[model samples]
Target: MHDESTKQPCCNPPWEPPQVIPAQVRRVNNLIFRKINQFHRENNVDNVTPMHDWIMSYLYWHKNDPVYQRDIEREFSITRSTVTNILQLMERKGYIERQSVPQDARLKRLILTEEGVRVHEKTMLSLHQTDEFVAGLLTEEENAELLRLLNKLRKGLE
Candidate 1:
């Protein structure tokens, strides 16, 4: 017979539930980021990180509109300096080019170069595969609900 009073606890005393939403979200994000980077490395796509891919994808989608560094900064919720450095690197890598608009010479518009388009298209397939892999982990209804909850959380922050 077991001695209830002398039984060892499976976990620490006064165990707390693991309900940290932000930390869980961040961990998942890091996992996805690592997976995408792995895809890039395996595909021989050099000098392109997930951040660079995202910006290039954004520029590609919004090709109809004139996008600037500020637009990227606002969209990604990053600082001007951070965006500037990333843009500079992208330019040097031939993935993007900054052009001065006639209306405001000081305002340089972001445009994806031919190389950017090529790489963006290639990397997008990997991204979509990664997304599908993640989504496949949940049921359709669960995925929908997760999206709704995530949107709610994002709106709360905004």
Candidate 2:
């Protein structure tokens, strides 16, 4: 005999398990993509595709250093030909220039044009906005822990 107090509550339902890690990661990735797209739309940056955006970001990071096609290939895990094709397209679009090194005539250094620098600055601002939005969710300690955990996971996978 069940006591009245112990009887099943009609208002409460059984809890389902939390989403798997991969699903959660995918959802987070989708959110980041959506935020970036929103930023692009708000900035009237419709001409910059995601690939162009990524390349611009990389170039910006190496703006002071001498960057080469092979550096991009190794960093991105993409083929040399793929890097060359993307660089060629970027060059045609007036985003970057390939200049021969006087010290190494065979080497062509990647240099961003004025237009590229402008675009890179804007892109960094948008990314910082997105980063701040996420950073606001956690304390400094939590943020550091999160980064540490993510790096650990990446290293384990690699």
Candidate 3:
């Protein structure tokens, strides 16, 4: 065995452990989140969190499509109860509404209200800014590769 003083016990590339990939990715995600939260605090923005902003953006992206609670649950990988709670809060905030489907009265589709549209437009800019800030840390090619690898990791999870 190598001497403890001479050998580094910690893992490092090109000998890094498999878990290192996810660990590093998580750290970067947390860093971005902290930055976004810090921006909100610095701007004295309240009544909304990053999650809320993200949901609004998603709704905006699919503004024309009919979405449901289950869809949000799947997209966010959250539980039904959690989605319900969040949707309730958003409804109260006038950000979203549940409309009865023509074919099925029991099925309610999720659609962004006018206020939600406005909020989404506002937050989308901030989201892009945050992404641009992170993208600036790498070359454009590296950024594309990073996204591809991240998507691969996500597919592995699925």
Query: What is the alpha-carbon RMSD of candidate 3 to the true structure?
Result: 4.5
lDDT of 1 by residue, 1-158 (tens): 87899876887655344556787898899998888877777777745888898999999999999999999999998999999999999999999999999988899999999999999988897788789888999999999999999999998998
Candidate 2: tens digits of C-alpha lDDT, residues 1-158? 75899777797655533556666778887898788777877776756666677788888888899998898888776898888899999999898999999999889999889998887777767677778888888999999998999889778875
Superposed on all Cα atoms, the candidates' RMSDs to the truth, in angstroms, are: 5.7, 7.8, 4.5
Ranking by lDDT: 1, 3, 2
Query: TM-score of model 1 relative to the true fold?
Result: 0.86
Report, for every candidate in turn, its global Cα lDDT versus the true structure: 0.89, 0.82, 0.83
Q: Choose the strongest candidate by TM-score.
A: 1
TM-score winner between 1 and 2, please give it.
1
lDDT of 1 at 66: 94
